[model samples]
Target: MTTATTTAPPVLHLAGISHTYSGQRRRTTVLRDVEYTFERGTFYTILGPSGSGKTTLLSLASGLDTPTRGSIAFNGQDLSHLGLGRYRNKHAATIFQQYNLLTYMTALQNVTTAMEITGAKPATGSRKARALQLLGDIGLDKAMATRNVMQLSGGQQQRVAIARALACDVDILFADEPTGNLDEGTAQGIIDTFSDLAHQQDKCVVVVTHSQRLAAQSDRVLNLRKGKLTEQANTP
Candidate 1:
C-alpha cells in the first residue's frame, strides 16, 4: 500500500520577537514578545496609534529590520538567516503611504522596474504587457499607465504603487498606511482591491493602518498598544 503525506501550509510566524532602540543613556523597547502567525488568503490589519510600533512590526515582518531578540520565520525558515534584500524581492512587497514611485518614470515603467528588481526576465513586449495588465487590475487604464507618475493625482499615483507592488508575484504584501492620503471613497476602493487580492489570490496581506474602516474590512484586526498585540472582536 502506498501512503500520501500531507504537508502543512506556509505561514509567516513571529515568535517572542522583540526590538529595542539604544540611545546614549537609555534604551527604548519598540516591540515586546510579539508572537503572531499570518496565513495566506487573509487580510490582516494591525491598528495602532502613532509611535505604537506598528510600522516597526511591519519592518520586522518584511525582513527590513532584524529583531533585537527572538525570531521571525516565513514558511518555517528563519528570516534572520536569509539575506533581507533578496528575501524582500523574492517573497515580500511593500506599498508605502507616500506612493514611492520614481517621478521620472511612467506608471508602466515603475511596474516594470519592480518586476526587474525581482529578477524577472520577461521580454520587452511581455514586460510592458504585464505592467499594463497590473495597472488595469488596480483600476488604471492604458493611458494612465503611460503617463508619468508626476502627472497623476494622489489616488492615481497610489494605484500605480499598488500595481508595482503586485508586479513581482510576491506571496506576502506589506502596506503601510496605504490610504492615508485618500478621501473616504478613494480609500474604500483601495481597501476593496486589497481585500480581493487577499481573499481571491490567496496572498498574505498585512496592512498597518489607523483607519477603522480599513481594519474593519480585514479578516482579522490586531491592536498594537505599548508594544503588544491583541485581537479585536467585532471587526468587519
Candidate 2:
C-alpha cells in the first residue's frame, strides 16, 4: 500500500496585490499586480531602488497596511477575513530600521509589552522570564535585557527588537533595513540571526535590504521594479 502524501500550505501568499495612493492633484500607484508565495523555513530578501515600494510591500505583507487591490493569505486563510490586527498579532511581526520599541521601556519591557498585545501567556514561566529567555536566545543576557533601549548600541538594540519580534511567537518576520545602522561585523551578525531564525527555527523571514551581503545569504532574492516582483538567481 502506498501512503498518501501531503504538502504544507504556504505560511503567507500574495496574489495580484496592488496599492495606490491618492492626492488631490494626482493618484500614485506604488505596487501593481504583484504575486508571491512565502513558506516556512526560508529567508527572502527584497531588493529595489528607493521609492520602488519595497517598504510598501513589506508593510502590506506584515499586515501593517492593506492593499488597494488583491489578496494576502496567511496560513491558507484570507488575510481580509483574518482581520489585520489579528493577522499581525497571531501570524506576523515587523522589525523596522528605526527599532520602533517603546523608547522609555527596557528591552525586556518592550518584549513583554508586545506579548500583552498578543494576549500571550507563556505556559512555562512568568511573562518577564520568557522575555528574558528570548533576549538571551538572541545573545542579550539579563543585564542587557533590563537596560533601557536608549542605552543599547545599534546592534544590541536591533537584537532586542528581534527578541521582541520572537516574543510575539509568530511564524513570519518582516524586517526593513534591519542592519542599516550597524558596522560591517555587526551587520553580518544580525543577518546571521535572521538566517538561523528561518532555517533552524522554521520562521519565514522577509527582509528588505540594500546590502549585497544580506541578499547573498538569503534563500531567495526578489527584485522589485515598478511595483512588480521578479525572482533572481541566488548568488553564492
Candidate 3:
C-alpha cells in the first residue's frame, strides 16, 4: 500500500490579471494576462524600466488596488472575496519608494505606531523594545530613533520605513526601490534582511527595483516589460 501526498497552495497567486488606467480620451493597459504564484520562504525581485508598470503590479499584488481583469488570490482564496482592506491589514506590508514616514513623529514612534495599528505582537519584550531593536538593526542608533523623521536624512527615513514594515509581522513584505537612498553597505544589509525574512522566518518577500545587485541576491528574478512579466533562471 502507498500513501498519497498533498501539496500546499501558493501564498499568493495572480491569474490572468490585467490592469488599465483610463485617461480623458484613451486607456493605458499596464499589465496583460499576468499569471504568477508567489510562495512563502522565497525572495523575489522585479526589474523593469520606467513606464513598464512595475509599481502598478506591486500595487495590485499588495492589495492596494484590484486588477481590471482576472483575479488575485491569497492562499487559494480570491482577493475580491477576501476583501482587499482585510487582506492588507492582516497579511501584507509594503515599503514604498517615497519612504512614507510620519514626519511629525520620531522614528521610534513611527515604528511603534505601525505595530500598534497592525496589532503586531513581539515574540518577547514590548512593542517599543521591538521597534527600537529593529531600528537599531538597520543602522539607526538610539539617538537617531528618538529624533523626529523631519530631522533625519532621506536615507535615515528610509531605514525607519523599512523598520516599520518589518515590525508588522506580516506574511508577505513588498518593497519598491527599497535601497535606492542608502549607501552601499546599508543597502547590502537591507538585502540581507530581506533574504533572512524569507528563508529564516518563512515569509514571502517581493521587491521592485532596477538594481542588478539586488536582483542577483533574490531567489527569483522577474522582469516586466511591455505589459508582460517573465521570470529569469533561478539565482542558485
Top TM-score model:
3
Which lDDT tens digits does candidate 1 get at residues 1-236?
98999876567999999999999999999999999889999999999999999989998999888999989888888886777887898999999777889999999999999998897645456888988977887678999899999999998898888888878778899999988877787678878878888999989999999888788889999999999987887755
Error of 2 at 68 (Å): 0.3
Give me the displacement of residue 124 in model 2, in angstroms: 4.1
Best by lDDT: 3
Model 3 weakest 10-residue run by lDDT: 227-236
Q: What lDDT does each candidate get?
A: 0.88, 0.90, 0.96
Residue 173 alpha-carbon offset, candidate 3, angstroms: 0.4
lDDT of 3 by residue, 1-236 (tens): 99999888899999999999999999999999999999999999999999999999999999999999999999999999999998888899999999989888999999999999889999999999999999999999999999999999999999999999999999999999999999999999999999999999999999999999999999999999998999986655
Model 2 lDDT per residue over 1-236, tens place: 99999988899999999999999999999999999999899999999999999999999999999999999999889999999999999889999878888999999999999999987778899999999988887678999888999999888888888778878877999999988877777678778888988999899999999988899899999999999998896432
Quick one: RMSD of model 2?
2.5
Per-residue lDDT for 220 in model 2? 94
**TM-scores, one per candidate:** 0.89, 0.90, 0.97
In the predicted model 3, the residue pairs found to clash are none
* TM-score comparison, 1 vs 2, better candidate: 2
Ranking by lDDT: 3, 2, 1
